[model samples]
Target: MMKTTKRSDRIDLRIDPKAKETIQAAALLRHKTISEFILENAMGAANEILAERRHFHLDAKQWEAFQAALDAPPRPLPRLERLMQEPGMFDGPEQEA
Candidate 1:
């Protein structure tokens, strides 16, 4: 059984007629009300967006490997060093007075 939570919040949106129709069609296909469909998808998207910045879990071996990688020194990149040394396009020749 699913637990129900009390809802006391309201959100209003103004969408184009075509968008509304599309949403309504999708909701009907899923057998959900428009509000339920929108809220479900919206929350799913929100969770995905926030997930990357929020938290992650790793097993013991994975955690050890991760720590090892973090502790390892960075490798030198000669090409990247040369690229950095080269004057950028924005670093144009000084204008003559």
Candidate 2:
């Protein structure tokens, strides 16, 4: 099977002259093009925004519980061995003749 790659659509955004100059200076200092600098910063901002949206926001007690779980000792159950060897529940029911 073949897969198709996605391409970016052209976008135009306006910024102040000072901001553009600052970006150009930074890009030059880093030996990157303005587009590369903008895309890098945009991707970082997108990741932060997306992570914020997808993560759970915990309160003090919940945070303590989460931390406690992380610090707690691991326990093993005998049933886990049986479960690990068995076919998954998702395998579905038997087929009829």
Candidate 3:
């Protein structure tokens, strides 16, 4: 599939002049525009943050257990079902303090 690199938004940041100069130097060293350098590095860090948030690295035994849990049929818990049927914290009452 063809991809587009059309930037249709803006993000303005205020930073120390020293930080800006440092970024400028880094960008020059990498032979990339300031925007490209920032986006590439920032996106790399962003991807790490998101991957850490969303993906798990399970060992073989843990993976087996995880798969088993997913494949198992639902178990009934009468207490839990009843608890859910009860009025929720915000519903139908003003509890005394």
Candidate 4:
């Protein structure tokens, strides 16, 4: 069944005239609606900020295993063929519900 929920919610913002002008000019240059441009720019900035503050610590043996997996050649899963043949698993023009 398809989801009946809506993911978007509306927001109201107040900004200095000069800041708004700069944002509008950048959005126009990018050929996006003001909201789209703002959301994309904000998301990129957020991801960068989060990346700088994020850290991961792993024990020596776990770290070695992680590195080994990364170095290994990719392997095909045996179940993939059966899964692909199953009906109505993918939602696309080629697949009928």
Alpha carbon lDDT of each predicted model: 0.97, 0.90, 0.94, 0.87
lDDT of 3 by residue, 1-97 (tens): 9897879998888999999999999999999999999989999999999999899899999999999999999999999999998989779786798
Clash number for every model?
A: 0, 0, 0, 0
The lowest-lDDT stretch of 10 consecutive residues in candidate 1 is 48-57
Error of 2 at 29 (Å): 1.5
Instruction: List clashing residue pairs in candidate 1.
Output: none
- Residue 3 lDDT (model 2): 100
TM-score for predicted model 4 compared with the true structure: 0.46
Off by over 4 Å in 1: 56-97
Residue 26 in model 1: shift from native, Å? 0.2
lDDT order, best first, reads 1, 3, 2, 4
* Residue-wise C-alpha lDDT for candidate 4, range 1-97, written one tens digit per residue: 8777664897789999999999999999999988989888889999988987896778999999999999999898769977877776455557556
Candidate 3 Cα misplacement greater than 4 A, ranges: 1-4, 77-97
lDDT of 2 by residue, 34-73 (tens): 9888988899999999999899889999999999999999
How does residue 93 of candidate 3 score in lDDT?
A: 83
Residue lDDT tens for model 1, 20-47: 9999999999999999999999999999
**Runs off by more than 4 Å, candidate 4:** 1-7, 56-97
